[model samples]
Target: MATEKLDVEKSSVELSSSVSDINLYTLHEERAGRLVVDPEEAKIEFGEAIASKLKLSHDGTKVLWPQPTDSPNDPQNWSEGRKTLHLLIITLAAIVPDFDSGIGIASLFQLAAQYNTTTEEINNLTSNWSIFLLGPGGMIAVMLMRRYGRLPVLFWSQIFALGFLIGCTFAPDLNTFAAMRCLTAVFGTAPQVSGLYIVTDLYPFHRQARMVNLWTMGFIVSPFLSPFLFGFLVARENWRWSYGIGSMYGAVVCLLIAFFMEETKYDRGVKDVPEPQSGLRYRIETLVGITGFRMAKYRASWKEAVMSQLNIVWRPHILGILIFEGVLFGFGIGMNVTNAVFLGSPPPLGFDWTPYAIAGGYGTPIVATVMGELIGRYLNDWIMNKSIKRNNGVFEAENRLWACYLAVVLDVAGLVLLGASIQKHLSPAGLIFGWGIAQSGVMICTVAVYAYCNNCFPRYAGEVSALINMARTMGGFAVAYYQVPWAEKNGALQTFGCEAAIVAGLFFLIVPLLQVKGRSLRAKFSL
Candidate 1:
């Protein structure tokens, strides 16, 4: 990364050789061939350190880097082998909070007997642990992801989370125990934000659903399976074993990521058609002004970087959509998650500490994400093709709207049925079955929402997905906390009912919003 001098007027100045990977789309298709790059333009744009590879270019002003923008070796474009490995690592990392988060259900009755605490507090603690982690951890993970790269953030956060888990394993007091759970929440969720980006970076837009479906296994399956996984551990031993086991899994994944997952922060050499800038506008703009305006290559001031994200967060359009996406993702998760705890703790629904109910809560849905994703993939493809045919070989952004509509309807209906089943106070089978259907929304929305977001925002695609993930995480946190007092005041059965009502409202709103806002590829191409 060496700097070079560009002369204008009488003065010569050095500019940063570094360039962000904003043009993720242009790389040679990694599915079959070689990644080629042009260095002459590399020299013109970024000296050696910034441009890593060289391919020649003729134009003095306009330049190209022969190296594929989304090169396979680029950490973002990790191979299928490595992508699967990464998800495995994310799965193990997830097992920590996920297992410990709800595994406590098995011990709640025992704990209430021994520690003299109420079932309500123990249940609330578990639900809140899962919910609050989504928001708070995601908030912090956003900054961590921007600064450290995805793999690094996940590795370090898991290591810290494991440490917190170890502390929870032996906490002498409930306060200390709850504090440790919160700590685990803070670190355990960092991996989630990075994991989705890992999928996007490596896979093409069309193939992304399959990769995302695979990823949903970890996110959707892990939580559902965690309770059951913890149950068997609880049966063999004590609740401490549950905490200790997931923590051990965490430590192992942390080590594996540190050893295998390469740092994805390398230069991809693809960039956007920069907003019209005076020659001076090309100067590096960090948080504040353009970097080269007064100085050589400029780094964003820390304050500026922080404020940049804040600015994005505050933009009216960004904020509105963020809220919409958050509600879409968070609603099903909050409803099913909070309701699952009712499987135990409540009498008539009681167990002799059997692992069956808890296991059922988390285990059935492993296939839900896989199944939903598999189905959504076909439906999404079918809809895209149908729209193109209807448009006479042209596609509209709104072409993707059908996927969103179908997913939301699936989710809302699932929640209302699950709520009704829970309110009916049926057998373990009815509740679990209803919940299983509700959980399918995770997979449906995962593909549909993501596909929609990617279609809508082509400019900063990775960050846009990351922002959506972050928003969803924050929404989960808010709704989870909201459910706590809500459960206390109204009870769990009613809380699910409330979620149903809210989602019913959201489903109606998103359809019209998309109708007005979305334009198909032809609509855009026509312009």
Candidate 2:
């Protein structure tokens, strides 16, 4: 029986690995062809005209697509205005879910007092349940969205998330509050995981960089901004308002999604494709969908999707990217958490910050985040485009690794400054400068790595997205769980300084390894 079980497991792995390649080949022929467009065909086919008009694909090459059916309903053929509106809705869907993450940090002291628990216990309420569950929730969302369709899963998930948010606001006890928060976490991750996939669905490779930046901005910004809003409310001893406001925002978003969000799951399988039906039954199916049990447009079974997430552990190149991102991101979160706690205390060096003051301090990094986004939006795009042009319209996954590699210097330098500021308990400006630099560096690194992943595994975009999401949340959970205690014991200089070295080392080691072996590995995984 044990041998049989082993054999079954091995077979499942093989079956799962084949699904992505099959889908890549059958559903999107051009994506499978991978930068092999012929110049003669470019002139004969309409690809050349579309390529020039839309600036699609690299210059000097035809746009490499199977050519959309020219239906107004086809997302590929949607007008720029329609696409922009959808992007706004989807970005909001991704942002609101994460506000719960840092919502209670400023109020932890008060929450602990109310429940007769330690502040550490109250802090655990955010980290242990919500942060830990985010990655798994993202994986679940990806699986469900692939099977059921993006609109129904996202619409329902946000509705449930809002209910849970309200429940969290009214919970009389910590356990009930934590349970509600866990449920919210489970549904909240749909937006981030699904939003990235939606961008891939709607935009081609040449246009993806900008949309992805816009798409991921909310995910990158929310955790940083959450404390700013909640800090003021928590300071007024009106902690419930934090969640109350979130629920209100969620309601608005859910309504918008229900009425406006379109289904993004293209290339449905023959077996799973909807048959022509009419009336109320058809309307309901069109809205909520009943095909979740069947193989989806991308052609992965439920088990295969889950396995793809699991298999991320063994992919060294991906693991390399994950480690670099995980370390930098987690350390930044640690800095934010520690800074809030450190500033709110009484001492010669401390500020004894009011809730509003804390909010103001938290807002400092928002500037840095925006600055980094602007730099990445232009500089990263320039680098990628120049590389594409230089390679004669060919693209490589490793090309974007340069941006990540360059960002590492900025990231590590900022970490050093942040550690110095914390150790000396410097002025607000010093802290702002340090935090801003660190946040900016990390943001650039994130954009670079994410763009690389999306390009490298367009066929398995959902699965790849889930892995990156999981890496991030798991890193946050681990760091948030330990950073405070560790800092309290070792001091900020030691804590952040050590973190910087780890992040830098991981980045340097992985980039060269991936550069050397990434193409071969991707080839092995391809059809």
Candidate 3:
């Protein structure tokens, strides 16, 4: 009787334990299914039931997309002041390439005179070549960043780019100047791609769009701002002074980065990683890349790093976004190039505007870009928050595309207005209004695209950024080859109208398809 009673108790305990195990398993399964609809699409659960299980943002109102580790070195946990300083440094660095490129535009006439060549030839040999290299340079920069470290790659590249800018300032001949320009672009493009990477490192998904807009404002304003300021400079002094000023700007950026920026590249996915040691030796090693090499074994192998970027290039959804962005961005570049020629050319063929007048015109895009930034800063996050609420705290990357609708409308209207104004010889105000409006639209589109792609593949943030940079630069490069000729062959009205139509049609067709089917496509062709 005693033996039987003991056996019965043992059996009862085993059954209860088994039930507990089953209950725990079921709970886990339920959480997994509810939390993520598609992992590749970054479908995250944000509110209520899972709040205690995951890391929440500081305010406790939303779940952090990347759950932070306990390590203090994690950039996500950095103090607000540190993040802001880093952002300012990166933004300034990103502005360097485009700013230098614009200096060439402002000095076009003077360069032609100095080289005994036509303005068209000077543009072709110098600015166009430099723009083409920016894409490829960004790819190389990201590869190095992945294999080495972000801080070292950025710092060294800026130093080399600064050297080349000095070369541009002192070049004695057109060939020498063109060569220097190309080299400057190759090294100068590091920050343009890396800025996005650093932003991803420093901020959560909810804040990335706003931070990206802030960083983007630097480059977006740069192209026009440089020309606006330097156009008059060139008219007073010579083109060399413009490049000299650029070199000074580059120097200032380099100093700020060297002193202030921290290495934001942290492997949060790794388990039991040791806290980074701090001291003079470690700091020196980190800055010069010795630490990166030592820690490289923890990161991807060199070959894997390079091949991963290529893989991202071929993914169907990413490829689609690249194509769409390239086409839309190409038109914006075309406008910038053509506007310079139109406003600066002699009376019969152009506006016959003085350098001062042309410089003032560039202000239109600057103001427009500012307006766009203000709207996009909060626009994407608001759209995303609403979607999350509607879907019961499940965040979908596709919701980010909603902002593009307003962007397309603005873009189309502005392009049409600019074209008609130019074709009909309308007043300067008409030109300015059209230019400002079109720029505002482009600015909004930039923010939406960057935010959406980053959300889709958070792990591959650097790769996504590099590819986007390629699409943007390569598109602009192609347009530069043909923008003026196309406008000359066809009337500006017809030319810009067709450009506007292409943007509208492509955006509507592609964006809607992505909105409805994007989740599935992401799952089917994941990185």
The list of candidate 3 runs beyond 4 A from truth reads: 1-51, 272-274
Evaluated with lDDT, which candidate comes out highest? 3
lDDT of 1 by residue, 1-527 (tens): 12323244223223331234323234332211111123343344345545454332334221232233434455444556776776666555555555555545545555555567776676567555555665557556655455434555666677778898798788888878878878887787765556556665555444555565565556655555556576556655777777777777777777777665544433343343222232332312321222222321132345543454454455433455567668766765565455544555354333222455565566656655667767776887787657655654344455555766666666666666665555566565665566666667656766666655554443233445556667776666567556645655565457766676666676567655655654432233221
Q: Rate the local accuracy (lDDT) of all candidates.
A: 0.56, 0.72, 0.82
Candidate with top TM-score is 3
Error of 3 at 347 (Å): 3.6
lDDT of 2 by residue, 1-527 (tens): 99999999998777566543343223343343144333444344323433333223346454544344434555767677878888999988888767776676656667778789876787677545687788888888887776677777888888888899899899999899889888898888888888777887787666677788887777788776778777877777678888888788889999888777777666633334443344665446655765443425545676776677666556665767887787777777666656776677654334577768878888877788888888888877788668767766556777777887667887788877776676677777777787888888878888887878777666667777788788777777777677666667777667778888988888878887887788886666543
lDDT (Cα, tens digit) per residue for candidate 3, span 219-251:
877888788889889989978999999999999
* Model 3 TM-score, 2 decimals: 0.91
Order by lDDT, highest first: 3, 2, 1
**Over all chains combined, what TM-score does candidate 2 have?**
0.86
TM-score of each: 0.72, 0.86, 0.91
The stretch of ten residues in a row with the least summed lDDT in candidate 2 is 24-33
Model 3 scores what on Cα lDDT?
A: 0.82
The Cα error of candidate 1 at residue 158, in Å, is 1.8
Clashes of each: 22, 0, 0
